[model samples]
Target: MSLPVVTPGETDTYEDPLDLINEIDELKKEKDASIMAHFYVDGDIQDVADYTGDSLKLARDCTQVTTGTIVFAGVHFMGESAKIMNPAKRVLIPDMLAGCSLADSCPADQLQVFQEQLRAEGRKFDTVAYINTTAAVKSLCDWIVTSGNAAEIIDRVPKDREILFVPDQHLGRYLMEVSGRKMILWPGSCMVHEVFSIQGLVRAKRNNPGSVVIAHPECPQNILEITDFIGGTEKMRQHVMSVKEPTTFLVATESAMIHAFQKSAPQHNFIPVPGIIASTGETCACNRCPHMARNTLQKVRDCLKNESPEIEWRDYFQQARAVLDKSLLK
Candidate 1:
């Protein structure tokens, strides 16, 4: 789906980001809008957010907030999740086109067809969807898993049940390895996480001796195998906070995370691992998620001022929310 292109507000054009930031704050109060940002987005967006967190935490925050409208500085799925949980509240994404590669990798129709094929083969199918999936995909799955709680959730599933994990092959592989559970994995990967070069990573580690490697589960096994710790964004934040000795971290995730860490934990040094081919075919050697980067301070001000690109509620969203509520309540 093509998202609406939002430019700067006509009447409230700002000379700089600070000016835009001031307008955004005033607009949020005037419109009764609360902003929720994802950790992987620009730090400027994060700073203006009422709350900033990882996927699972952000979804929970969406449910708890009492605002009339929600402006999410994240991907399409993240905004959809907010709308799903809070059907009555208006939810708007800063950039409508901000999409996740992992979410796009698994289309809902294809996933439904795959499930049907498995059922026809006389198999009992239980599926776990990564939160990065669309509302339609979540509705089709038996349970949802985030990188932080995936292993814990998977361990609780009965050993007799056959499990299928979707939309993130790397995380699925990691879960299977840790839980000793054999399951079918969907062939999907995050474009940002797929770019880590083992050779370059080794060189980075060698250059900075005594540096600890913290990787996201979305990363390939080769990267995960050499990591000192692996978890979600929240866990990485916690690990960084708890370090007593001075430490330098080799972060194997999006470059935005390094910015977040630097702001919160200024004492620590962070070096993001470069992509195999650093050119990005357009920019410098920066490892950033293009989709997440689509959201800018200008877009945030424009979205809040106009509220033009609100998420449309659908029947399937209710079904997806039911699935999530059932698992979460259990």
Candidate 2:
């Protein structure tokens, strides 16, 4: 069965967003469902969510959910992770089409073929996958890492074994620099992160003097080079909250994350670093993930109320769960 696609601006149909929020709350109670929202989603969804965090935190949070159903208000990979961790519970994403570019970059079959090719060449390596992957890809991985715990997991890798990091070369490169361990990185990157213009970033920094730059490792090396701090969504929030004085921050991650920053530290100012179409050099608010935007309050309510687009458990999910347990749970 095909799920419904949330067209652009479908959310604007809601005459009163508060009414939608109330409807979602009622649906949650009626359906015995818990909503897990990522920091990158719109603030309305986060405010109504039962749990809100980055991928690593959300994975762990879902394991502790007592509800019979999970309505993931993030991208498709997040819904898959929730289902993998809690196979007993029904997992549904607001929009099944809401998928991560990083996950889409490395399909399971392609990754398998690449791994086999490496093995044939007598390259001994452990497959370390970033959490932004499909369940099928996760099943084939030796270890799964999120931005929050990636460095620690990398440090835990045996010194003798080579590491094959899949999906998100920018993150892989950053890991290499931080961990001092060279990795065979798959040439994949987040579309949003990849577009952040170095020119726009420099301009934002200059315009807002004394503004601290907080960037996600998923950004290109050029952007990371000039940033004042580098961390994941949750870590970025922590860093900003630690600052005692009022300050402006130029965020080099998804623009929606600024919502969380404002909520956490209302005294501070947050601005998204604009992105540019590499070919045209025209600046845009391209830092927001289109996938994340696919999720809407209407879709969330509809998914919970209907419960038709549930994430079915696959046989390979058992294998994925084992790695998720080891990497995120530990």
Candidate 3:
């Protein structure tokens, strides 16, 4: 796929970044497009999105929207999900290279081999794929789920059936513990979520006493153990909003979500969990996903203006819908 062309070193040098937002809005209207952004994208992208939420929510919105085009302001898999939902609509992403590390972990061929081995062993099982996967990997699964509905969807599986949970071992473990159902887990992880330094988090907590710790289930066990609340993005926001008492929170997810939380609850303080300390004693910017950061206002404007970087779904993508439609939510 050809992406919008901007000269090297031109990403941050938009003549006026504010003007790009206006241009993007005009293009959206002219193209009859709606923007769907993930919570982890840049704050400016989120601000311009017609719908901004978790993966599942954005996919659902894509199916429901009457717009002829869907401009996804997040990562590549997210754009693919929107394409899966609306096969005929034009789906575009700001950056075609904005990929997910978790999605990269499970190749379709590897999953196919695993499934074949399971069947050869007389194991009849259902596969549950996290939404953070490639369209090809998702096509291989019986059901697709987000962290918010994973446990609920998994519970609906018959008690006698074995299950395979993929593309995020930490999330799989969390589901296994919560639902008390054992399953084979694919060893995959989000780089940003997995690198949070336990030492750094502990230190931050001690320094900011009385702060509640909120973490995504994708975090490691050590992070979860110290977490006051563990949930998906929307659920985390709801938890913070539900509490009337003003409280400080140490968040252990993508740094961009902190911006959303602060916007939702400006009265409360939200500090991101620092990454592992370098030899210089400085923490890495591990809380941010480099892929997510690939998106910028300049890219958005250029993609919308040119209408390039459109996602094209293969025939298998269409076939996958038959299996997906049989599962709960399409």
lDDT tens readout by residue for model 3, 1-330: 112334476555535657878988999899898888899888888898899888767877888888998889889988877887789899989888888899999999999999999999999899998888888887888888788888888987888999999989999999999999999999999988988889889998999989999999999999999999999999999899888888999999999898789888887888899976545766764577878888887788878888889999787887566655555363
Instruction: Please identify model 3 stretches exceeding 4 Å from their true place.
Output: 1-12, 277-282, 326-330
Output the better candidate (1/3) by lDDT.
Answer: 1
Q: How many residue pairs in model 1 have overlapping backbones?
A: 0
* C-alpha RMSD by candidate, in order: 3.6, 3.0, 3.2
> Better model by lDDT, 1 or 2?
2
lDDT of 2 by residue, 120-157 (tens): 99989999999999999999999999999999999889
Q: Write the per-residue lDDT of candidate 1 for residues 1-330, one digit (tens) a residue.
A: 112234466233334878978999999999999999998888888999999989888888888898899999999998998999889999998878888899999999999999999999999868999999999999999888888778878877788889989999999999999999998999999999998888878888999999999999999999999999998998998889888677899999988888678777888999988677656432223677889888888888889988868899988987899877766545
Structural similarity to truth (TM-score) of each candidate: 0.93, 0.96, 0.93
**Rank by lDDT, descending?**
2, 1, 3
What ranking of all candidate models by TM-score puts the best one first?
A: 2, 3, 1
How many residue pairs of model 2 clash at the backbone?
Answer: 0
Task: Estimate every model's Cα lDDT from 0 to 1.
Answer: 0.87, 0.90, 0.85
- Which 10 consecutive positions of candidate 1 have the poorest summed lDDT? 1-10
